[model samples]
Target: MCFDAIDMRVFDELRKLEMFFKEETRRGCSIIDLYELVQHAGNILPRLYLLCTVGSVYIKSKEAPAKDVLKDLVEMCRGIQHPVRGLFLRSYLSQVSRDKLPDIGSEYEGDADTVMDAVEFVLQNFTEMNKLWVRMQHQGPAREKEKREKGRSELRDLVGKNLHVLSQIEGVDLDMYKDTVLPRVLEQVVNCKDELAQFYLMDCIIQVFPDEYHLQTLEVLLGACPQLQPSVDIKTVLSRLMERLSNYAASSAEVLPEFLQVEAFSKLNNVIGKVIEAQVDMPIFGAVTLYSSLLTFTLHVHPDRLDYADQVLGACVKKLSSKGKLEDSRATKQIVALLSAPLEKYNDVVTALKLSNYHHVMEYLDNETNKIMATVIIQSIMKNNTRISTADKVEALFELITGLIKDLDGNHEEVDEDDFKEEQNSVARLIQMLHNDDPVEMYKIICTVRRQFMTGGPKRLPFTIPPLVFSSLKLVRRLQGQDEGQDENPFGDESLTTPKKIFQLLNQTIEVLSTVPAPELALQLYLQCAEAANDSDLEPVAYEFFTQAYILYEEEVSDSKAQVTALHLIIGTLRRMHVFGVENRDTLTHKATGYSAKLLKKPDQCRAVYSCAHLFWVDDQDNMKDGERVLICLKRALRIANAAQQMSNATRGILFLREGEPQVTAAAIQSLIELINTEMQSDSSTPDPAADAFFASTLRYIQFQKQKGGAIGERVYVLMFLGKRNVENLSAYWFTTKSFTTNLMV
Candidate 1:
C-alpha cells in the first residue's frame, strides 16, 4: 500500500488497540490472554504493535520469561515488509522494551544463552531498521527524490535509537562493546554507504556512549572515519568527538586522571595525526579546522601538554604549506580563522605558536593571511593575561610583536600597502596592554615597541608613531603620580617621587617622536612633556622640550595655520612661567618674540607679536615696569598690520580677492586697537616715543579706511582711549582722523 493510505489506517487501528488494552487491563487479564490476542491479529502492522504491547505486559509480571518474550518481540517486528511500516514497527519495539527489559548484570549466573539472545535481538532490530531506512530512498518515483530525502531525514532518529538501546543494555562490558556491539553497529553504518546515514549515526555514537568506553576504543572509532562516505563532512564529526572528550575531561577531572594519565592524550594526538596525513583528498581548510578543534581539546584535557599543541599546529602548517599559492578562497579564510583561535590564554598561545614555527608558518601564507594572524596574535596578548611582570615573558612577547610589525626578511621593496594599516591598528592594541604597575619595566617594553614602529615601515610611520608616543607619555604621567581629581597644575608636583626617571623617559620619547614628520603631533607631545616638567619643577628639562617644539614649528612645519597654532601655544605656555628669575625670564621672552616675528602670514604675525608683548611686562606684579618693551613690540606689529592692509587693497583691485579677506583684515585692525587699549589701561604713566609713534600710525590707518567710506567705529574707540590718556600728545593725530570721531559720536 501507499504510505498515505497506510498512515491513516494505522492510526485508526492504533486508537482501537489503545482502547482495547485499557479495557483488558481493567478486567485483570493475564499476560497469556494478551499474547494470544496479539497472535490472532489479522494484519502485519497491528500484529507487531500488539505483540510489543503484550511483551511489555508480560515483562511487567514477576514470573514472566523476559528473554523469551524479548526474543518473540524482535522476531515479530520483522514481519512488516513496507519500509516505513517496518521502521516504525522497530521504533515501537525499542521504545516499549526500554525499561521493561531484564538487567543482565555482571553477576548473571543464569544461562548465557539468555543474554546472547537479548543482545542478538537488539542487533537484529537495528539491522532491520537500517535496511528499511536505506530502502525508503528508492521506493518512491525518481522525480520525487527530494521528497524521499526529506522523509528519510525526518526518520533518522529511529535508526539512531537502536544504538541508544544497545548502550543502555545491562551486561555489555568493554569487551562485548568492543568485540561484538561496535563492529556490528559500524557494519550497518558503513554497509549502508549513505552520506546522511553515516554523518547522523557517527554523531549519535559520539554522543550516546560513555567517555570511558570511547577512551578505551578511541583508535577503532577514529579508524572508522576513513570508511565514511566521500561526501560526508568528516571535520564536523571529528570536531564533535573532540568536543565530547574535552567535556569529559572537564567534568570528571578528579577521577578520570587515571584513565587519561599519559595514554589518552598520546592516542588522541596519534589518531588526529594519522587522519591529517591519510585524508589526502581532503581540502586544506577541513584539515585545519579539525586541527583547531583538536587544539581546543588538548588545552582542556592537558593544558600543560604544550608539545601536543605544537604537533597540532605542525599538522596545520604542513597542510597550508602543501597548497600552492592560496587564493582568497573560503579555504584560505578558514585556515586563517583556525590560526586566529586562542589556543592558550591570549597572546601567549600565539606567542608560543609563533616561537615554535619560527618564521616558517608566518612566511608560508599570503599577505592577508599574515595580516589576520598578526592582528589576532596582538589582540590575544591584549585580552588574555595582564600579569606581564617578568622580563623573559615580555621579551618573548615583543619578539613576536617585532616580527609582526616589521619583516623577518630584509626585503620590503614590493610591500603590500594594505597590511600596514592593519599592523598599525595592531600596534595600538599592543600598547593598550602595557599598563603595568612597574613603570620602569613598562617603559623599557614601550621603548622596544616604539623602536619597532620607527623601523617598521617608513611610509606609515607618520600616521602610526604618534599614538605610541602619546601612550608612552601617558605612562610617564601615571608614573609621575598625577591625578585627574586634583586641580591641574601645569608645573606638576615638584616633590614627585620618580621625577628623575619620569623626566628621562619623557625626554627620550619626545626626542624620538621629533624625528617623525607629524608636526602637529610633535608639537603636542613636546608641550605635554614641557607642562609635565614645569609642574615637577624641572626647569631645564621643561625649557628644553619647549624649545624642541619651537624648532619643529620654525624649521619642520610650513602650514600657516599650524604656525599660528604654535605661536598661540607658545604664548599660553610662557604665561605660566612667572616663576622664572630675571635672566631665565628674559631668555624665554626673547625666544617668544623671535617665533612671533617668524610667522608666515602678516595677519598671523601682527596678532601673534602683539600677543607675545605681554610676556615682557608684568602688569599686576610690576605696574607696567616694562612698558617701553611692550611699545616696541606694538610698533613692529603696526608695521605688519599696515603691510597686511596694503596687501588686502592690492588684492581688492585685482581678481585675486578671496571670500573672507576683507573681514579678516578688519578683524586684525580691531585686534591691534584692542592691544593699544589694553596698554592704555595698564601703562597710563610711561612716556615712550615708540608707543606715541605706534598709536599715530594706527590713527592714520583708520582715517584711510574712513576716507574709503568703510566703518571704523571700533578702531575709533582706541583713538578715544589713547586721546583720554594723552590728549596733548595726540591732538594732531585726532585732527588727522577727525571723521572717525565724528562717525563714532553720530
Candidate 2:
C-alpha cells in the first residue's frame, strides 16, 4: 500500500477515537482525560496527533475559543519535521477540523473565531504542506532521487487538497481570494524552487479556484508564471487557466462585459508572451500549443474581434519565423491545428483569409503537411458554400492554398499520382464555388484564378484550368445578357468587359493549357467557348475559337484514334456553327477534311471524311447547302474506303474492310439516292428486305447506265462501285440499304 493509504487506515482509527470522545461528552463524561493521553503519549507524533483530535472536540464543547484550539494544534504539530509524517499529520488535522473552522454563519463562528481564522488555518496548513512536499525531494540520496520524486508525486494531492479546502470556504469570496488567498498560494508556489511542486501547484491554483476569482486577480496569478523553475511547462499551465476562463466567459452572455472590464484577454496575452520570452528553450510545439489555447480563448471571449485572433496568429508566426521550417512532426501537427482553429471557428475560409498572418503561419509546415492543411482549408470553404465574391479575395484564397496548387520549393519527393490528383480536384471544386454578381468583377476573378492556376505546371493544368475556362464562359454569357438593351455597355472596359474579350481570355488560357499538351480537354474547352461565341452572335470570335480548336487538332492530336475523335468533334462543332461566313466556313471545312484524309489509318480517314460531309450540307440553315459538294465529299469517302480495303488485302490479308467500312458504304448509297432524287425527282424508293439485294440492283442500274453513258450515271457508278470489293457482309452493317433508300426517297 502507498503511504497515503496506510495513513488513511490510521486516520480511520483516529476517527473512531474522536467519535468515542464525542459520545462520552454527550453523556456528560469528562472528555478532559483526552489531554492526559496527549501528554503521556509514547511518541511526539502520536502526542501531537492526539492533541489535535482532542482539541477539535474541546472547541466544539465551547470550553475554549475555536481559534485558540486550532492555532495551538497547528503550532504543536510542527514538531515532527519529518516530511511525509508531517504532511499527513497536517492533512489529518485539516480533514477532521474542516467543518468546525470558524467561518461566517458556521456553528463555530464567534468574536475571535471568524472567517479570517478559517482562512488562516487553511492557508497556514497549505504553506506548511507545500514546504514538507518540497523538502521530500532533498532528503533522499542523490542516486535515489527519482524514487523519492515518485514517492513525492503520490503525496502531491495531499498538498493540493489544502488549496481545495481554501476554495471550499464560503467566506473566501472574491476579495479574500484576490487579496489573501491567491497571493499566499502563488507566493508559496513560486518560492518552492522545485519544478514538480511549481508545476503541480500552479495548475492546482488555476483549477481549484473559480474562474471569476482568476479573472479578478488576473495580474497576480499570471504574474507568478515566469517566476517558477524554468523546467516547468508554463504553457500547459497557462493554457488550462485560459481554457477555464474562456469557458467561464462562454457560459453566458452576461459575463462577457465583466471579462472585458477586467482586460482578461490582454492580461493573459501579456503573461503568455512574457512566459514564452522568459523560457528561451521552450519547444516550438509547446509555444504553438500555448498560442492555440489563447486563440480558442480569444474566439470564445472576443468572437467579434478579428484583430485579436490575427494578433495571436501573427505572434505564432513570429515565434516560428526564427525556427526555420518546422521539421518536427509534433510541432508541425500543432501548427496545423493552430492554423485550422480559426477556419473551424468562423466556419469560413474567407474569414480566416482576412487574417494577414494566416498564410504566414502555414509557411512553416513541410510540404506534405502544408498540402494537408491546404486541403482542410479548401474543404472548409466548400463546406460553408462561401462564395468568394471579389477578385482580391479569390487571389488571396489561392495564395493561401498555393501549396496544393503548385510544387513548393525544395519539395523533391515524387508525389503520389492519385493523391496529387485528388488535391487538385478539390482546388478545382473550389474554383466552381467562386462567383461574383458583377460581371466585370467576376471577369477579374476568373483572370485572377487563371493567373494563379497557371503556375501549377502542366500536371495540375488539366484539373485546375477547365473550371476557370467554364467560369469564364459563364461570365461571358452573363455579360452578353446584360449588354442587350443598354445604351452604354454594362461591362466597363471595351478591352475587358465585352463577351468577346472574355472569350479572348479563355482562348489564351486554353492556349496555355494546350502547351501542357492536354489536347483533348483543351479541344473540348475551345469548342464550348466557340459555341458560346456563336450564341452571342459574335461571328468573328466564334470562328476564332473554331480555328484554335483546329490548330490544336493538327499540332497536338497525334494518335490515330485521338485524331479521329478530334476531327469528329471539329466537324460536329462546325456543323452547328452559323456564324462563319462562306470564306471562313470553307477554310475550316477544308482544313477538317484535309486533316481527316491524312489520319494514320485509312479506316480513320474514311470515317472522318464521311463525317465531314455534314459540314458542307447544313440542312437547317439556308446559307450553306451545296448538294454537289456533298456528293463530291461522299465520293471521296468511298475512294478512301476502297483504298483502305486494298491496303487491308495486301497487309492484314482480310477479305472485307474494317469497322468503319460499313458506315462509309452506307453514307455513299444514301448520298447517291439523294442526288438522283434531286435531279430526276423520282419517288420509286421502297423498303427492301435485303440490303445486299438492293445494293446489287443499284449497281446493275448504274452499270447499264454506264454503257449508255450519262454524266449523272457516271458519277453514281464511280461513287457506288469504288469500294465494291470491300463489301463482304451487307447484313453485318449497322445501317442497311433498305433504311437508307426508304429514308432518302421520302
The residue-by-residue lDDT of candidate 2 on 361-451, one tens digit each, is 8888888888899899888888889889999898888878889888899565787889888998999899878998887798888888888
Could you tell me the TM-score of candidate 1?
Answer: 0.67
After TM-score superposition, the amount by which residue 69's alpha carbon in candidate 1 deviates from its true location, in angstroms, is 3.2
The reply for model 1, stretches above 4 Å from the true place, is: 1-12, 18-64, 76-82, 104-117, 136-148, 170-180, 255-259, 324-426, 435-447, 455-459, 470-517, 523-552, 570-591, 598-603, 614-631, 634-746
Candidate 2: Cα lDDT at 467: 83
Model 2: residues with Cα > 4 Å off, grouped in runs? 26-28, 481-493, 631-746
User: lDDT per residue, candidate 1, 1-746, as tens digits?
Assistant: 55446645765676576566756866888667878878888877777788887677666563456777787788777788798888878877877676755557532214533556567778888898989898988897999989999889988888888888888877777898888888888888888998888899889989888887887788778878877776778889889888888888878668467446646667766766666666677777677678778877777786776676677777767777778666646666766655554434334643464336433445555655665666666766666754455445555555545556665556455555675666777766566665566766766666566666667655556555667766666765675534222223333444433554555555665566667656777777787777766665556667777778878877877888887787778777776654455776678788889888888877667667766655755434453236457656766766776576456421000000011224324656556556555554453334445455545655675576679886644321222222233333334433544223443221
Clash pairs (backbone) in predicted model 1: 347-380, 347-381, 491-534, 491-535, 492-535
The model with the greatest lDDT is 2
User: What are the models' TM-scores?
Assistant: 0.67, 0.84
The C-alpha RMSD in Å for every predicted model, in order, reads: 11.9, 7.9
C-alpha local distance difference test of each model: 0.66, 0.78
* Candidate 2 backbone collisions, by pair: none
